[model samples]
Target: MDPEALNPVIDKAVESGIPVVMFDADAPNSKAYAFLGTNNYYAGVTAADKMAELLNEAGGEVGVVTHPNQLNHKERTEGFRETIEKEYPKMTVVDVKDGRGDQMISKEVSEELMREYPNIKGIFASEANGGVGVGKAVIDQQKKGGDIHIISFDTDKGTLDMINDGIISATMAQGTWKMGYWSLQFLFHLQHDIAGELEGETNLPRYVDTGITVVTKDNVNEYYPGE
Candidate 1:
């Protein structure tokens, strides 16, 4: 999220009497009206907690697999690193690898990480492809069945299967349904329902957290689409 690059475009929209609201990812410095999607930082914090639990809270070395170019991934990595550093002082994020949001790239990078950080006890995948790739690396390195715990993001069916098969410890499921549903609601309100300023504040909310859910083997069936 380059504020310098995005703010001018958004500011132009606002100046033209057009409103812009961000979803999923954001450049808060931009002149966007609101952001309605997952609270990515909080989601990262939760992922760290889950990773700690999977590691039995022993606090060992872990790594992160992500797309370095994406802002949301950066935020997640930041939150995960901060939580581990502050709350679990014994654990260290040994390294962070860029997957470039590609399955093959994520797998290759994760494999390299495993070789470099041989003692890594946990891995956090900050996106769908990163999770899939890291899961494959764990299996290929003969470290399956929770040997090197993995906490991934997204509720993809393949990811859910990995959770059941014990390749991934769990996954963070975003409230995409809520995001899609409420996007229309928020837009509708912005189009016609928003009243004028009240006590120097607008009627619209600045941010709406659609929320997240941790999907594990126990609840994989509930999240996965059935045949």
Candidate 2:
């Protein structure tokens, strides 16, 4: 949806004295009270560090698969590229392709990327669908268990399965539960004017870092329900 379409909705809500807290994806131009979700940039940094470890610091070209136009994905891609340049001189981000947050499209793009850069040693997928798609491409090309490493974001069932199957090396697990909990809490406080009770404070933090964790083979099972 066009982001501009949300401007009036947000304005209407705020005009009606309703508090809006964005999570996962943000509309910065809107009058939302706050954005509560993972620090996407740091999540990318974490993916870079994990990729470096998986690559044993030897370094090789890496590609990024993500939603290029989305704010959160852009930040993640930027963070990953910046960290690679700053901390891992040998690692280079060779390409960035828009996955459109779809499995089939990401798979197609990953196939093209692999063909274009056979020397590509790693890939960072900034979202779950892209992660699963990249893993599928790797598996189809018989690159699984090979030198190519994949680091992705989120712990969706498919991504977790890929990690367990040794297709994806690791993934950054966002604090989705916390995002929901805190978003509601913030809205409640705003509805009740809870912050007004405090001395001179009338608003919640404009942004919150929900958090992230690197999910790898060693602890992948722990992330599942009733595990």
Candidate 3:
């Protein structure tokens, strides 16, 4: 269903007495019981920070590629653009391409981007597949990876490999496993009649900060997934 089309279904679920929590992205208008995922907007800002740290000096066009038309990607791009414009005014965002979440399409799109914007100084990917796709493009083109900073999302195996080999400069980490675990845990509690809201002013993390981390070549080894 289209994002606009999801609100009704979400409302129906909520009406039927189901506690809903959206992962990866939130449905602001829907009656979602809670949001358990990364602070995507901040994640984009984090990406910009990583890019600035990697480049050390700003004043180049930043290109973003992701699954086009996705609400999450759209928010990320907006956040990244807003931060870059406010903080690194010299760094112009030249273009954004749609990867369609397909590796082959991502490669093709990345190749096209390379040709269109040869001076692209930085690249930001908002999803795992897109990041790996862009990584493959950089490797295939034989560009000096370090010369052009690349920031990606997630810690998938392919992304980790790229970080290790120095193809991707950094990646934004997300707690995929924790999201599933907590979502179910919350649902279980709701079903068990446990109070959903906080008891008092003692404070409650209204949203679970599943957390995020920046993975780079310098610290990539530290983030190797558990065997």
Question: For every model shown, what is its TM-score relative to the native structure?
Answer: 0.91, 0.93, 0.87
Query: What is candidate 3's CA lDDT for residue 175?
Result: 78
- 1-227 in candidate 1: lDDT tens per residue? 45357888888987786767778777788777788888888889999999988887888899999876677888789889999999998899999999887888889998888889888898999998889999888898774333688899998877988998989998999999888887777676666747456685457888899999998988888987762
Where is the poorest 10-residue window by lDDT in model 3? 197-206
Better of 1 and 2 by TM-score: 2
- Model 2 — which ten-residue stretch has the worst lDDT? 194-203
Residue pairs clashing, model 1: none
lDDT of 3: 0.79
Q: How does candidate 1 fare on TM-score?
A: 0.91
Q: If both were scored by TM-score, which would come out higher, candidate 2 or candidate 3?
A: 2
For each candidate, the alpha-carbon lDDT, in order, equals: 0.85, 0.89, 0.79
On lDDT, who's better, 2 or 3? 2
- Measured over all alpha carbons after superposition, the RMSD of each candidate to the real structure, in angstroms, is 2.2, 2.0, 3.2
Q: For model 3, how does the per-residue alpha-carbon lDDT over 105-184 read when each residue is reduced to its tens digit? A: 88788878888888877889888898898888888677554256679988888999999888898999887788999888
Please list the residue runs of candidate 3 whose C-alpha ends up more than 4 Å from where it truly belongs after superposition: 143-146, 196-206
Worst 10 residues of 1 by lDDT: 193-202
